[model samples]
Target: MGNRGGILPAVGALALLAACSAPAPAPVAQTTTPASASAKPPTTGPSSDAPALGPGPGSQPPTTPQPPPPNSPAEVTSACPFLGVTESSATMGVVLDAYAVEEAKTTQQDATTYHCTYASRTGGRQLLDLFVTVVPGTGQIPSLVTAWTKDCKGPAKPIGGVAGTTRTCSLDGADSGDVMVLVVKKSHGQTRLAELYVRPFTDEVYAKLAQLLTDRL
Candidate 1:
C-alpha cells in the first residue's frame, strides 16, 4: 500500500425548486373615456407598475450547519485496526495483521486536537484504523494510543512492519486513546509521517516508508 496523498473534499448537494407560483399579476388599468372628448388618458398605473409587496414573511431562514458525512472506506482503511492501504495502490507495502477479533468497526480519537479517524474490520480477531490530523504550526502533536475495553480481549500489542523504504512501529496499545510518536533518526527530517500514527521501524519498513514519503510528500 503506497502512501497516498490527500484528496479534495466533495461538493455539497443542492436541491432548488422554482417557486410553484408567482404573485398575482398587477390589476390592469381600466380606461373610462367620457363621451365629451378632451378627457386626458390616465397616467401609467402607480408610476412603476411593479408590486408593492414586502419581503416574504420568513423567506429562506438560515440553514443549520450540517454534520459531516460518516467516514468513508478511504478514511476507515487509513485508520485501521490492523492494516491500511493507500487509495493510490494495493501493492502490500504495509501489511496489518489483526491479532484478535473478526473484522469490526471501532471509533478512536485524541483529546488534545482535532483529528479524523476511520476504522475497519481487516479479518478475524483483528481490526485496524487510521487517523489523519493537522497539527497547529506552533502546537504539539498528541501521543497516539491503542485502547480497548476490559471485556474486549485479544492481542492488543503493537507490531513492527516495513512499508516501502520507511520503517514503522505499529503498536497495539490502549483501546482508543493516545499513542507515542514513532520517529526514525537516519532520515534526519528528509522523511516524516504526515497526519498519521505508525509503528515498526525496521530497516526494510524504513526504506519503504521513506520512499512512500518521497512520492507522497
Candidate 2:
C-alpha cells in the first residue's frame, strides 16, 4: 500500500510539469501600406490627343491674306495713249473722222492685242490699221520678231534711238501701194509688237510713228 501511494504522487507531478511546459499559440503578422506609395505619379506632359496650345502672350495675331494682281490687261475703250486719231490722221495725210478700238486675246500665243482702225467719215474707207500686242515676257521677243519678219526678204532694221526690231514690206499684187511695218519692243518684262498698215506708204511717216510707239512701251 505504501508503494502504490508513492507512484500516484509521482504521476500527478509529471502531469503538472507537462501542462506548464506546453507552447503558446503563434503571433499573427500585420501588413500596413503607406498612403503616398499607393498613389500614381503626377502627370508631367501633355496627352497624345490633347488640344494644341495657341500663341502665347504678346504674340502677333495672324495677318490677312492678300489677293494677287490681274494677269491680263484691263479692257481698253479709247485709242492707245501713244497713238490717237490726230496722230493717225497726220500719218495717213487724210482726214480720219471714224475711229474704233478692239481688244482681242490670242490663246495660242498667250497674247493680248489691241486693234485700232481709222477710216474716212464720208465713204468709210479704211485708211490705217494698227495692232499692238502685249506678251508676258521678254524671252519670246526675239522669236516673235523673227516670226513676224520672216517673209519680209531683208535683215531686221534697228530703229534709231529705240530698243527694238523693225521691218518694212511693200504689199504686191492687188494690195500694191500699201505698206506694212512691224516693230517689236520689250519693256518692264513685257514684249510689245506694234504692226501698222498704211496706204500710199512713206518711210518718214512710218519711222516717226514707230519711234513714238516704242518710246512709250
Off by over 4 Å in 2: 1-79, 103-105, 151-163, 173-175
* Number of the top lDDT candidate: 2
Query: What's the TM-score of every candidate structure?
Result: 0.25, 0.54
lDDT score for residue 12 of model 1:
7
Pick by TM-score: which candidate is best? Answer: 2
**Pairs with steric clashes in candidate 2:** none
Q: In terms of TM-score, how similar is model 1 to the real structure?
A: 0.25
lDDT of each: 0.22, 0.41
Clashes of each: 59, 0
Cand. 1 Cα-lDDT: 0.22
Over 132-185, each residue of candidate 1 has an lDDT whose tens digit, in order, gives 221112222111111111111343222244232222332233323221222211
lDDT, candidate 2, 100-127, per-residue tens: 3332222122344444434333334455
